[model samples]
Target: MFAPFAPMLRRAALVPSVHRLLPSNSRSLYQNIIKRHEDMATEHGSPSSSGEMHDALDVLSSESSPISTIPLDPDTDYAALAIPSLQSKNKANLPPLMNIPPQEDPLLHHIASRIMNHGERAKASRTVSQMLLHLHAWTRSPPLPILRQAIFKLSPAVKVIGHKHSTKMIYKPVPLSEKQGIWLATEWILDAIKGRQGGPTLAERMAREVILILKNESKTLEKKEAYHKSAMMNRGNIAIART
Candidate 1:
């Protein structure tokens, strides 16, 4: 008798949970709930596998991006125009990395620092190194000796100064200290480099000029001569110049 009553006992235990899910229902309401559950079971049979989920995602991605492409011109990049950095190709195709720089000599460092502008010291250092390499190639000898010789030959002894004398500017020949002389030499050399008509880079132009300086053919030499002549002509004003 107990065995026969087991199914009825289980059904009676579920009655409370079914009642909680539905309003106080008659026989027809219970039948409708069962029919709805059966329909739902048929509609959504089982959970999706990982492969099925991935396929769905891939299909969605393909549909959303059927013709993906990147624009060559940044001006036409409508996507990231608002961002300042990406607005221009400022991050594109930079120059190759510079070779080992000549930084052992303090004099060389000082010259490199002068060559550097706008805080870009790396380029200056590389240019200085290139100058050495060029010197070596031209003379078929150690570069340092030639470099020192050029600097010594190119360095000027005196700099011209002007004094206000009775509504006239009187030029004075002022002897430059070692420091002043080196700085002035560097300035003049750089100025000459800038004035050169042809050369892709400062290093090449400067190297060519240094080689010419060695050969006594550079405009830097001419400039030095002009300064000396001016100083000689204005030697009278030397008395007025500060001691």
Candidate 2:
């Protein structure tokens, strides 16, 4: 009986110490978990469970301020935007006056003065003559029948005084040399200058018409440019053939 009672007493004494040790271990574990959470938040650069994070989030979610407005440029061409086509057409129709060379021919000067007394008209006539001369000079050989046919394919019928002053008109493709072409062109241009029956004088009308015709006849220049471009592209083949 004494032996059994002694064992029971020792067991009862160990219970309080075990309970005290258990409370200290639990407190230390709780502190360690809290410290680990704080360190993780600091490392990640996140808000540490504070009201300052809420304030920062609110500021970020707020609406942005409006951008500052700027006035239109004073130098902007508003009228051009309204009538662009008409403006472009007018610019296209403007005469290439700068291309006209100065006139020295006494006959052209006299005729220009007699018709309009303007120096500009004389210069324009000279320009027309020079253009025709250049066209003639560009020919590598005497005019071909095919070239004449092609050029005059759309030739207009001409009315001429026939026998007993009866008028006759006909379309004929006559082969012409460079000199003849220049001569004919000069005569036609002169006739155009002097043949106005009414309205503006011949010189004034001729000056305007020459510029308009040059613009309209740009297709010829375009064709020449195309031919040169083709020749340039095939130059290597031409050289090979020559060799």
lDDT of 1: 0.73
Overall lDDT per candidate, in order of appearance: 0.73, 0.46
Instruction: Tell me which residue pairs clash in candidate 2.
Output: none
Q: Residue by residue across 31-67, what tens digits does model 2's lDDT show?
A: 5665666577777876455345444333433344234
Model 1 agreement with the true structure over 1-243: per-residue lDDT tens digits: 599999989877665333333344453464565556556665787334434544543443342324458757756875656576554555575667887865488667878999888998888888889888877787799887777778878788997988788999887898878777778778878888776566456777777777888888887888789888988888876665466
Q: Least accurate stretch of 10 residues (summed lDDT) in model 2? A: 154-163
Residue 156 lDDT, candidate 2, scale 0-100: 24
Error of 1 at 22 (Å): 96
TM-score of each: 0.52, 0.21
**Cα deviation of 11 in candidate 2 (Å)?**
99
